[model samples]
Target chain A: MSLTHREFWMMVHLGLGVMFLHTFFEGILWLHTGERLRRLRIGTGVMALVAWLTVVSGTWLVYPWYRAKPPAGADLADYPRAYLLANPSISQWHIFGMEWKEHVGWLSPILATAVAWTVLRYGGQLARDRRLRQVLLVLFVAAFTTAGIAGALGAFINKVAPNTFLDG
Target chain B: MAHIEIDPVTPSIIEEINSLTSSSDRPALPNGQAGAAILSAGIGSALLGFFVVLAEASTTAKQLMTLDAGVGPLSGKTTFAVAGWLIAWAVLHSRWRKQTIDFARITMIALILLGLGLLGTFPPFYMLFAQH
Candidate 1:
């Protein structure tokens, strides 16, 4: 069966989330002594590839979503847009959260690339050095946290938007 | 000589790796610090771009051509942000290549600078002050 747009997008999003979780797990495993650094490096490299793919797919997902509008002349019916205009404080907070999610989401590729590159270049040192391991741990946590926050914001947008893939 | 032979398959390879890890003469690696800063720079610049675009969306939206295709200032702003981040990363990477400075410390410094750069782009700070 041919995949619908919603199905395709859903699959992509699921892939993104899974890749992100995979990175998180690999990062945790990197901190352990039992696993060889070489294996973890390869794992992170795969995560980076998946992450960049996710970034591209997410962009495809976002563009149409951002461009969406209500049926012509449906002013106040736009829900959050119209409601948000009347309430500046709530609007600001909502906008801030939305923007934060979008912006941070863009860093997935960068974060994943960094993790992969660092491991590739310094895996030996990182495996041996406590201090370096700590830094890597922090970077991993930050990347995971950003993905989580961005995903939360996307869920919020789906709930508030005029139409969502779930509606059909 | 006593005929003593060791299997060179698993144990020898593992022992070699162990010996390498124990060696103290290894070159200084980035330890994930510079890479982290570069990654964070992407986040910071994207955030800065988002706020900057939002601050100017009212005016910029007018000049931006909205097509049947979703071409808008938001996409432009994102592109601009990502470009800026790539440039910043390039510069940092160059310095990282040349310098012998403590990798983690320098990365922290870079992160702080990028964070400050982000704060500078806030609407209340740059936009408001400029308009006045």
Candidate 2:
């Protein structure tokens, strides 16, 4: 069966989230041994790209449909945001979960892009500077954490109110 | 045993790397450029939080931030954040590119700002500021 536009893009977003985790893992390895700085640089760049893809797609393409307001007396089935909010029991999923996810998720790409540009600009100098390595590591991990939180929330939110199709 | 030629003036590869990383007097690495990037990331994050909280607290701000109807206020919030981040990055990078500044201070400040940004995005925190 062909996927709805929403389903297709959300799936792509999920894939990009996984890709971010993979690159973030590479960054963590730098703490143990600073042997492969070049690889770490590449990882930063990849993380930036993946994060941009994930957030941009989620925000611009998928979010419109997710947050599409249901008309009065209309069925809330297709509107994930409204569906979650309509039910007293599940309202927290939208109020807390989606609220936090959509807002915090944007930070990942910004942080990732900064890290990528720094690594690309400094290049080999990073390998020789321990302070630089440590600072980058902390921010890199923070980037990963933000993306991770967003990713987990997205999964849980979708499970609660799956975007099976585009409503509007 | 084979004799290795040792240069009297130049340090060994390992020694050079160790000193470049750890020595207090070694200030020629142009690390300020890197610090610029790191600090700006924090600024960008904090700016995003600022916008989120602003939108939450002010109805007018929320309406103004709705740059796109479909995407809602998030469209403006993110756009402004990204724009602010780039502007900060450019300003910092230009000033610090040729100089070597203290990395430790920059790192501490950046992390603190990042923590605040993280807290600001929290629904419980930002929602408390929401205008009922």
Candidate 3:
């Protein structure tokens, strides 16, 4: 069965979210075990791949789709554009948050690859080194937090933005 | 490559290290290899975007931009990004093979490259932030 653009994007988002959770759990496992998990490196690699997909879909596909088919008339009557547009402060914050999200979203995949590379190059030594482990932990947390925030901002955008995704 | 024979520093540490080093399929890449991938991908994509923005395109060209060439600055931006990353990987991979590279130093070098690539993404860096 063919899926609509909105459905496809939602599936992509869900996949991205799941991958982030998996990476976080893998990180915790490594930390708790105090042992290097080879498979964790593989997990990070997969997470990076998923992140790349999210970036491409969000940046190239979804943005253009939204730009081309902004919702209108009765389609947006129930949408909460006023809560964002009517207030200058809220609008500014939303725009600022989105801008940051765009850039940071790009950074996530890079960070993921770095984590994987570090794990592969360092082997079990990374787990033994307190500082390196801390660094890896921090990067993982940053990637996870960024993905969550981006997802949240995206939901907000769908509610307020002039987009065809909601229009029947 | 100077291999460090690290004694299992702690009992809690797994015996996996010895096996890891012995594994042929999962080769131990150099310390800075991962950073190189990050730098290459970031810089490559940005450079592609910059060039596309600089180019003059007709309405047809813009409309023709689809998934095959969509999302990034140009068609195959991801492909270019991956290529750049792999090239860096190969270069760094070979460099570390010839000499002893420390982990901390590898990290610092990677950070420097990443910082440069990040800076490169902002057009202002090329223009010195002057209003063009």
DockQ: which candidate is best?
Answer: 2
Model 1 lDDT, full chain set: 0.57
Candidate numbers, best DockQ first, in rank order: 2, 1, 3
* Model 3 spans > 4 angstroms off: A1-3, A28-36, A69-94, A125-135, A162-168, B1-86, B112-132
lDDT tens readout by residue for model 3, B6-30: 6765532454555445553454444
Look at candidate 3 and tell me the lDDT of residue B102: 64
Sorted by lDDT (best first), the order is 2, 1, 3
Pairs in steric clash, model 2: none
Q: What is the DockQ (computed on Cα atoms) for candidate 3?
A: 0.15
Error of 1 at A150 (Å): 0.6
For model 1, the docking class works out as incorrect
CAPRI verdict (incorrect, acceptable, medium, high) for model 2:
acceptable
For model 1, report DockQ. Answer: 0.22
Query: How high a TM-score does candidate 2 get?
Result: 0.88
Residue-by-residue lDDT tens digits, candidate 2, B3-33: 9997874555665455335533444457778
Docking class of 3: incorrect
Task: Give a tens-digit lDDT track for model 1, residues B1-132.
Answer: 799787767785785487447543676654334554454554554555454545464554424422224434445555655666667667666656544446566557645644544454443443443321
- For candidate 3, lDDT tens digit of each residue in A1-168? 777766677668657756665567767577445465666666667777788788777776554443332245444333334334546756743444554344445556766666676666666555555656665665566567657666666766655554445332
Give the CA lDDT, 0 to 100, for residue A85 in model 2. Answer: 86
Question: lDDT at B110 for candidate 3?
Answer: 48
Cα lDDT tens digits for candidate 2, A17-79: 998887677677853355555566677788899899999998998888889898998778878
